[model samples]
Target: MSTVTTPKATTRKPPTRFEIRADIPAPGTPEGAYFHYTPAEAAEWLPFSVYKLLKMANARQIPYVDNGKRITFSGMNIRAISEQFTVEPFTKPARAAA
Candidate 1:
């Protein structure tokens, strides 16, 4: 009789989230920092979908740069837009007694 052994399978780990840092300027001073990203990259970092991002850009709801051919989003603008749509969790009301 021959003994048989099975090899263990290996799985790849998920990628870690990237963190964003901004250089905030003093009051009454113009901002000098700028970072641009495509819709797909923005979608990866943000919670909104690519379609939603495009819709918002079309509606002028979010700040974006349109260079005649392509549309790009700035990191600062994305942060500002996300802040405007922030929502708190809802609390359920107490059940009525019979």
Candidate 2:
């Protein structure tokens, strides 16, 4: 059996930060604009669980056509719902005069 040698650059430290996005336009969005995200993509964007999303969809009965139980949502629809359902921040009320 032959012995393998390690490369000289093995001691070098790798860069800490990495860029993951690409220049490709989103599938459902306009070119050179914001990228469109699918349901799975939306799942990645937010911190909610798939089960939670499903429950929300079921509760609200969001309009979506099914292809043999395979449901699909448009990027536009997801964006609209996300914006509509988001909770706005509230400021504390001023104290009443004593």
Candidate 3:
């Protein structure tokens, strides 16, 4: 009679490296998906002027704050507005019902 034993094999995971990138300005935080930006920074990033920026904020609910003399918006808010304007052809009403 004889007894034999075998050692189990071990598996190794491949080496991995991850890189993070950011273009957000100062005084803001990165939430789960979007970055926040102060209103001054928002004005710079946007095409509209300071006054127009205020109007945009009020009209579009662009998420902003108005101090006694200044106003600021969050980058996160801008991202949300962008999503609202984005259109998907497939999502639109079907021209001819299937």
Candidate 4:
């Protein structure tokens, strides 16, 4: 009979917070700085579904950075996208004079 042995698997610790870098300069806005966001993080900030965010990226409607294997969005880019969908509150019309 032959003896067999298996190695134990190692677990990784989850990060407490996402990494946000400010050194990178945002495109178009030279004086402004922005942070990068993972796809999931972008979704949370946009308050939209991840699926929709990915779709927008794929369609080239939103700007993103492709770091070989993963994609990231700049804070400035997200803000610009959000502004397009902003809605104003509605108010009732004034009553007509007698």
Model 1: per-residue Cα lDDT at residue 30: 40
* lDDT of candidate 4 at residue 24, scale 0 to 100: 40
lDDT of 1: 0.64
Clashing pairs in 3: 37-75, 39-72, 39-73
Q: What digit string (tens of lDDT, one per residue) describes model 3 on residues 1-76?
A: 8988798898874211121224545333455234434444555655555566667776755666454434445566
Cα lDDT of model 4 by residue, 10-61, tens digit: 9874322244444544433644336666666666667677778778888888
* lDDT per model vs. reference: 0.64, 0.49, 0.52, 0.65
Candidate 1 error regions (>4 Å): 1-33, 88-98
* CA lDDT, candidate 2, residue 56: 60
- Order the candidate numbers by lDDT, best to worst: 4, 1, 3, 2
TM-score for each candidate, following the candidate numbering: 0.52, 0.43, 0.40, 0.52
Give the least accurate 10-residue stretch of model 3, judged by summed lDDT. Answer: 13-22
Best by lDDT: 4
- Model 1 TM-score (2 dp): 0.52
Give the CA lDDT, 0 to 100, for residue 37 in model 2. Answer: 35
Measured with C-alpha atoms, the lDDT of residue 42 in candidate 1 is 64
**Model 2 agreement with the true structure over 3-42: per-residue lDDT tens digits:** 9988776575421212123353443465413443333544
- Candidate 1, residues 12-97, lDDT tens digits: the string is 74222132234433212244226565676566656888778888889988887676646666667667766778898999999999
lDDT of 1 at 73: 65
